[model samples]
Target chain A: MNAIEVKDVSVYYGNLCAIRDVNLNVKEKEFLGIIGPNGAGKSTLLKVILGLIKPVSGEVRIFGKDLKETNKILGYIPQTSGFDRNFPINVLDVVLMGRLKNRLSLFHRYAKEDMEIVTDLLDKLGLSDVRDRQIGQLSGGQLQRVLIARALAIEPKIILLDEPTASIDANSRSQIYSLLKELNEEMTIVVVTHDLAAVSAYFDSIACLNKELHYHGDKELDEETVEKIYGCPVELIAHGVPHRVFKVHEEGYDD
Target chain B: MIEAFLQYVFLQRAVYSAVLASIVCGIIGTIIIEKKLVMMSGGIAHTSFGGIGMGFFLKIEPIIGALIFSVLTAIGITTVRRRTNTNSDTLIGIFWAMGMALGILFIAFTPGYPPDISSYLFGDILTVTELDLKIMIALTGLVIFVIVALFNYWKAYLFDEEFSSVIGIKTIFLEYFLFVLIALAIVALIRVVGIILVIALLTIPPAIAKLFTFDLKKMILYAIFLGIVFSFLGLWISYQFNIASGASIILLAGLTYIAAVIIKRS
Candidate 1:
């Protein structure tokens, strides 16, 4: 069964079509990467899948259930650049927020079980040392890890991340990708990012998008598809390493 | 000061108003600052002036009018801010100007001589009646009840609204609810510091508290304590110097905010 199914989704921001007639499907436990240029509605598409933005037309299904009914199983990590670092909250509290229920009760408390899960997640993410420190005190790398821990605290079947490694250092970026690779063993992972190098290296499948999904399925990105998405002549984004380089179409290109 | 309180009911009511206002302002102000809604709050506070004017025109309790106007304005601001691409500050500025204009119009249309609006404009803590005290008590209690009941939810909602919505936390409803709370807090504060200076009380104490603590709960507690101290000091200064109580209180808070910043820096 597919982990996510987006059918005929069209989103508009004040009559400007953001994502138009987008159809996508992700298999369970598949690591998917969504790449697009700036202003390509990449974030908008992610928001639509998360049920944060209402599409003008179409439906999203998660494990054969409607998106609205299946929100509890969806964990999200938003762009860290947009976060308020000065917010008066600690790592423990931020992660514990993932344990919140949507019940209609006046008084709610975090149970002992919730604390245990948060503690274990903090330990797993190597964030136990900064559990009590305010979010503003953490480094860029640590903040990204903390957000990841928060997302994992929900024990989600499908976890989504938006620009999880946009501004962090290369070492931290590599660490995050490898961590996601490890977690992909148990749950479906979807990421929207501009990091083409990392996407080629880690993602099981890649989707190139520009106002609409231009290509989907497999990690092989042809030059024509890249041009269709970016609308410009691009340079060598993929480097030859243990990872597969792009199947070069030009005669003089080296592996 | 002790003898004065014993001799005067007005002085006693003033102190009660101060303490009650402190509790509400401390909690809500922290939220307003954290959410970066200070300008919106100031806009809401100013718009309530229209309600006060409407009250005078219709021969009704001005605070009730202020409450209605403030709440309506909050809903309006929240809806427009969320649904439209209009610049937030531009929307707030319009509301602020329109509210004051409406107030002026309402007062002009009233048949009788203009009422002495100084108390509503600036504030007269000594003018607080028993009914005003009762209103303050009820409002303070309501504020505390709502906050306590939804403490954790509020923490999540304020931190990351989009993520909260993705997690099924009803971010839209929470935003509207928070705006209404801000309106209520502003109304409760009207009789104490008047509309113009209400934002000062709402923002200053919390700003001071933020400098010392990073915990939301501790920030509230410290803001409450700081609010009480500042109100008392301002009250005493107003009494001793024969100045406007509202201005004195704002001045004191502003000075203390500067001092706190300096102290924290070094």
Candidate 2:
């Protein structure tokens, strides 16, 4: 069974259609990248799959189970920009929230095993040094890593990330990409981003979306295909590597 | 001093009730402040005025009426907040005025309204009864117990609502639970501090405690300690000056908050 099955889904906010008639199926352990311009409903699609937003129409199924019924099995890393960086909480405490479901009762103590799991996840994320530091004190990149660590603490079957590297520096962005790539080896990963250039090289498959599904396939997309998806001509500019730039056909202006 | 302490059982009851109420208020106040629901507490306290009026009309226990009205309003506020796109604070303000107006109408209709509306307006700690003491103890115990039991849930609730929901923490349930707890605390406090001054107690102590600590747990403890100290000092000042005890207590807490703000700014 497909790990995530979204069939003919449309989402609307009031009269404005966020996403229209999008259908896609993600197989197990697949690294799927969702790319589009701003307001293209990329995050909306992820939220719909995560069951945070109800689609105006169509159904989403995870592991053959309905989306609404599979919340516990899904780990979501929402856009970091939406979070309050000054929120007063510690790193370990933030991660331990992921284990709340497994606790027997409200009063139940955190088991040694639970602590060990949290500690291990922090170490893996290279955040063990700031385990006791308040979340407010962390830098943007550190905060993003902490959020990822929180998602990992759930031991989810699939992970959904929305703009994980939007505001971080290049070095941190690459590190996050490498970490996500490694995680994809063991879990189904779905990333929603507008950073098409760097992402095309990292993602196994690309789902180009703009309110509707422009393209959905696993093969490496060439410049013409990306330009078609973006409605412009494409240029391969070197930003360390040859990065594809979607150029406007009329003015030859890179977008 | 010994004679003054023993001369009035009512004064003794006031001290006992204030200590218990302060403790409960201190802990719950921290949550309310952190959750950014200080205005909601004010709304709940004002809404309880309708309950107070109802109790006066029926010649029944006003605290029961206060609890019912406050909890129902809490539920209503929570429901409206979830189902609609309207700003919650606006809804709360509208209800606050409506409740106050209803309370006045009810009191006017009642024959021979109690001359001691001041107690409901500004708490008369000296007039606390044995039943009031029992109720305070029970409610305080229950509030503390729930807070301790739901430590992880409360922590998650405070940290991030969306993240907590994504991780399957039952965000709605926890939020409603908090609303109910706050409603209970408001009801219990109505008799000790009166509705007018109750919001002060709920906000000031926690705001003052915030200045001293960054840790949430430590902040709550400090708030509780400060709440108790302010309660006693306010009660003493009220006695000495023959003023309203509840208002005096709130004034003390408010001053402390102001002082803390100044200190932090400097």
Candidate 3:
């Protein structure tokens, strides 16, 4: 059964269509990468699925249930830009937020199990030492790991991340990909990213978006689809190897 | 100061006002700084002037007017912000100016001897009445109660609003609830520091506390303690120099923050 099913989804900002009539499906435990250029509605599509942004018209289902009913099953790692990094919250407290599902009592306390889950995730993400440090003090890579730990703390059936490795060192980038690759064995993963090199290496499936669903299927994308999604993108390289992504140019083509 | 507190009801009320103002300001001010809502809070503070003017025109207690105006402005700003494309700071500026304009108009139209509006614009803590004290007590209780009860959710919301909503935390409700709390906190401080200087009291203590701690609860406690100290020190300074109480408090807090910054860097 599909873990996520999005049907006829469209989002608009004013009259500008952000994403249009995009339909996609991800089976359980599948690793899906969404690739698109800037302003291509990649982030918008993720927000729609997370129910953070209401699509102009669409239906999103997780495990055959409505988006609202599937909150506990969805773990999201949003891009870190939208919030104050200097906020006075320690790493442990930030990760512990994932356990906030369905526990809305006044004066609620974190269960003992909640702490264990967060602690374990922190250790796995190599964030144990920075557990008590302020989020503002973390490097980009460390902050990304904290967000990953937070997402995992939900014990989600499906995890979604937006640009998870956007602003980190190359070494940390590979570490994160490997971590996600390990986690993929247990849960479905959907990532929106601009890292084409990592895309082919990590994602079992890929979706190309440009304000609409240009392509959605396996990792082997045709050159025509690539050009259509990026508008001007002509070349693609994967995994530090010179992989042919575009049609070979004619000898007389402009240099 | 101890003997004076026992002798005069007004002195007792002033001390009470100082402590009460510190409590709400410490709590809500930390949120204001953390959430980056300082300008919006200032806009709310300035807009309450219209309500104060309305109270004078209607012959009711001015703080009551200030409360109603601030709550409405908070709702207006939040709603319009969500539905419209107007830049938030621009919207805040509009509300800020409109509130002041309305206050000026209301005060001009009121007949009889012009009331001493300086106390509202620049708070006269020495003149805090029984009614003001009661209102401050109620608001302080509500602010503390709400914050403590929703502490868990608030941390999440402040850290990452979008992720919190995805986790089913009722973020919209939290957003509106927070704005209203800000309004209440502003009104609660109006009698102690007045409108113009209230922002300082609301912001400075928390800003100082932030330098010392990274934990939210510890930061709040430190802010409250700092707030009380600044208020008492300013109160003493004002009494000794025969100067404006509100101005003294704000100046002391401001200078202390600068000193703390310098010391930390050193």
The candidate, 1 or 2, that scores higher on TM-score is 1
Candidate 3, DockQ to 2 decimals? 0.74
C-alpha local distance difference test of each model: 0.89, 0.83, 0.90
User: Over the stretch A33-137, how does candidate 2's per-residue lDDT look in tens digits?
Assistant: 998767889999998887778888999999999865775688878777776555556888888888777332758677798899999999999999999998878
Q: What total of clashing residue pairs does each candidate reach? A: 0, 0, 0
Which of the CAPRI classes, incorrect, acceptable, medium or high, describes model 1? medium
TM-score of chain B alone in model 3:
0.99
Ranking by DockQ: 3, 1, 2
lDDT of 1 by residue, B26-77 (tens): 9999999999999999999999999999999999988889999999999999
Candidate 3 interface RMSD (Å): 1.3
TM-score of 3: 0.96
Model 2 residue A232 lDDT score: 53
Q: What are the per-residue Cα lDDT tens digits for candidate 3 across B167-264?
A: 88888899999999999999999988999999999999999999999899998999999999999999988878888899999999999999999999
DockQ (Cα-based) per candidate?
0.72, 0.50, 0.74
Please write out the lDDT profile of model 2 over residues B1-266, one tens digit for every residue: 45787998888888888889888888989998888899998998999899888888888887887888899999999999889877998999988998888888778888973546779888888888888888888889989999998887888878778778777667788888889999999888877899998988988887888776767888788888988999899999988999989988988888888888998999
Interface RMSD of 2: 2.3
Q: Identify the candidate with maximal lDDT.
A: 3
Per-candidate TM-score against the hidden true structure: 0.96, 0.92, 0.96
Tell me which residue pairs clash in candidate 1.
none
